[model samples]
Target: MTRFLPPVTIALAALVLWQLVSFIAGSHSVSGVVETMAYLFRMMQQESFWLDVAESGTAIFYAICLSMLFGWALGVVIGLNRNVSDVSEPILVTFYSLPKVTLYPLVLLLFGLGLSAKVAFGVMHGLVPICLITGNAIRQLRPVYIRTAKVMRLSRSSVTFHVVLPAILPELISSLRIGLSLSILGVLIGEMFASKRGLGFAAVNAMGLGDGTRIMAIGVFLSVCAISINFLLLEIESAIRHRTARI
Candidate 1:
C-alpha cells in the first residue's frame, strides 16, 4: 500500500492540474478528466474500437519480439569482441542519436504502407538502444566470468547462454524496457502517418474532427497502459537486480 502512494498522489495531482487547465481553456479546447473518462468508456463499448486496438496490439507485439531478438543477438556479438565493440560503438551512437522520424520516408519506401511498415519502423526505433546498452554492458562485465568460461572449455554458445547472458540479465532487462517503449512509440507514429487502422489512426481522426474529448480520452488510455507496463517491468527488473545482488 505504501509503495502505491507516490503514484496515486501524482495521479491525483495530475487530474487536479488537468481540471484547472480545462477550466481555464474552456471545455471546447480541453476536456475535463471526468469527461475524458466518460468518452473513453464509450469508446470501449464499440467493436470497431476493439478492432483498432487489436491491430495496434498485434503490431506492437511483433515489433517488440523482433527488436529483442535482433538487438540481443547483435549486442552479444558486438560485446564479445573488443575490436568490434571499439569500431562499432561510435557508429551505433551516431545512428541512435538521429531523429527516428527522419527515417520514416525511407522505411515507408522499403516496407510500403501496412503492418510491415509499422513493425519495421518500430524495430528501427528500438533495436539500436538495446544493442548499444547490451554491448556496453557485456564489455564492462567482470573478466573473471569470461576466464572461468574459457577454463571450462565451454562452446561459444554455451558460454553466452550459461555465463554472459545470465550475468548481464539486469542490464538486458533495463535495455528491454527502454526498447519496448520506443517500439510502441514508433508503431503509433507509423499508424498516424500511413495506416488505416489502430489507436493512432483513431487519435488522428479525432484530431481532424476537432473532437477534444476523444483525443484526450485516447491520450489518457495510452498513457495509463504505458505507465502500467513500465511499472510492471520496473518491478521485474528490481527483483532481478536484488536476486543477482544476493547471489
Candidate 2:
C-alpha cells in the first residue's frame, strides 16, 4: 500500500486538476477522467478497436523478440572481441544517438508501408540500446572472473553459459525494459505516420476528428500498458540483482 501511495496521489491530483481546467475553459480539447474512462469502456467492446490493438501488440512483440536475439548476439561478439569493439563502438554510439524517427523513411523504403515497416521501425528503436547495454555489461566483467574461467579450463561455451550470461543477466533485463517501451513508441509512430490500421492510427483519426475523449482513452491505455510491463520487468530485474549479490 505504501509503495502505491505516490502514484495514486499524483493520479488523483492530475484528474482533479484536469477536470477543473476543463470546466473553466469550457473547451472540448481536454476531457475529464470519467469521460475518458467511459469512452475506453465503450471501445473495449468494439471489434475494430480490438483488431487495432492486436495489430499493434503483435508488431511490438516481434520487434522486442528480434531486438533481444540480435542485440545479444552482436553485443556478445563486440564485447568478446577487442578489435571488433574498437572498430564498431563509435558507429554504434553514433547511430544510437540519432533520433530513431529520422530512420523511419529509410525503414519504410526497405520494409514497405505495411506491418513489416512498423515492426522494422520498432526493432530499430529497440535494438541499439539493448546492444549497447549488453556490450558494456560484458566489457565490464571483472578480470578475475575471466582468469578463473580460463584457469578452470572451461570451454568458451561453458564460460559464456556459466559466467558471462549470469553476470550480464541484470543488465539485459534492464535493457529489455527500456527497449520494450521504445519499441512500442516506435511502432505507434510508424503506424501513425503511414498505416491505415493500429491504435496509433486510431489515435490519429481521433485527433483529426477532434475526438478528445478517444484521444484521452488511447493515451491512458498506452500509459497503462507501459507501466504494467515495466513494473513486471522491474521485479524480475530486482530478483536477478538480489541473486547475483548472494552469489
Candidate 3:
C-alpha cells in the first residue's frame, strides 16, 4: 500500500492543493509558495546557507551523541537495578512530560544565548526520550541471555558486552532517531531565540522584514531536510532489523 502510493505523490498532491487554494482565494498564497521556492534556490546558490546548515547540523549531531551516551548509560543502569528504576522512573517521566522549551529563559541565562545555549537546549530535548525508550527496551529483555551467561560462568564485563549491549542497541538507535529530530528542533529554536547565523536566523529575519514568502521558503527547506533525514533513518533502521532477524 505504501509503495503503491509513493511519497512523491503526497508532495504532488500537497502542491496541487496549495495552488488551488491560492488560485481560488488569492494570488498571495500561491505566489508565496513560488517565492519561497525561488528563495530556496537563491539560498542554494549562496555558500552562506550551506555553511549555516553545516553549523546547525553539527550542533544537532553533537547533541544526539551526548544524549545517547548519557541516556543509554542511565537507562541501562536503571533497567538493571530494580531499586534505581523504582526511584527514578517517575522523575524521568515527569521531565519527559514537561516541555523542555519552557526552560528557555533559564538556559539563556546560564548559557548566554551562545552555541552553549543551543547545545544545552538540544541536550534537554534529546535526553528524556532516549532515556525512557532505552530503559523500556532494556527492561523488556528476557533473562535467558543473562541466565545462559551466568551458567557459562562468563565474566561480568564479557556478559555485558556480548549479551546486554547487543540486545539493547536497536532500542538505543530507535530512541536516537527521535532524539535527533528533537535536537534539530532545539538547535533551530536556540538559533531563532538568539544567534547570528543559521536557518533559524534566516527565519527570524524573514519574519522581521514581513517577508512571508521567505519565511515560507525557510519552512519548506526545513520540511525537505526533515523528510530526507527521516527516509535515511528509516532505511538504516530497516536494514539493521533485517540483519538482526537473519542472525
lDDT of 3 by residue, 109-187 (tens): 9988667788888999888888888878867989888789899999877876788878876776778888888888888
Candidate number of the best TM-score: 1
**Candidate 1, 109: how far from true, in Å?**
1.4
Clashing pairs in 2: none
Error of 2 at 75 (Å): 1.4
Tell me, what's the RMSD of every candidate? Answer: 1.0, 1.6, 2.1
Q: What lDDT tens digits, residue by residue, belong to model 2 across residues 14-119?
A: 8899889878866477877788888899998999999999999999999999999998888888888889989989999898888888878999899888889999
| Model 1 stretches with alpha carbons more than 4 Å out | none
Q: What is the C-alpha lDDT of each candidate?
A: 0.93, 0.90, 0.81
Q: Is candidate 1 or 3 superior in TM-score? A: 1
Q: Which wins on TM-score, candidate 2 or candidate 3?
A: 2
Q: Which residue pairs collide, candidate 3?
A: none
How big is the RMSD of model 3? 2.1
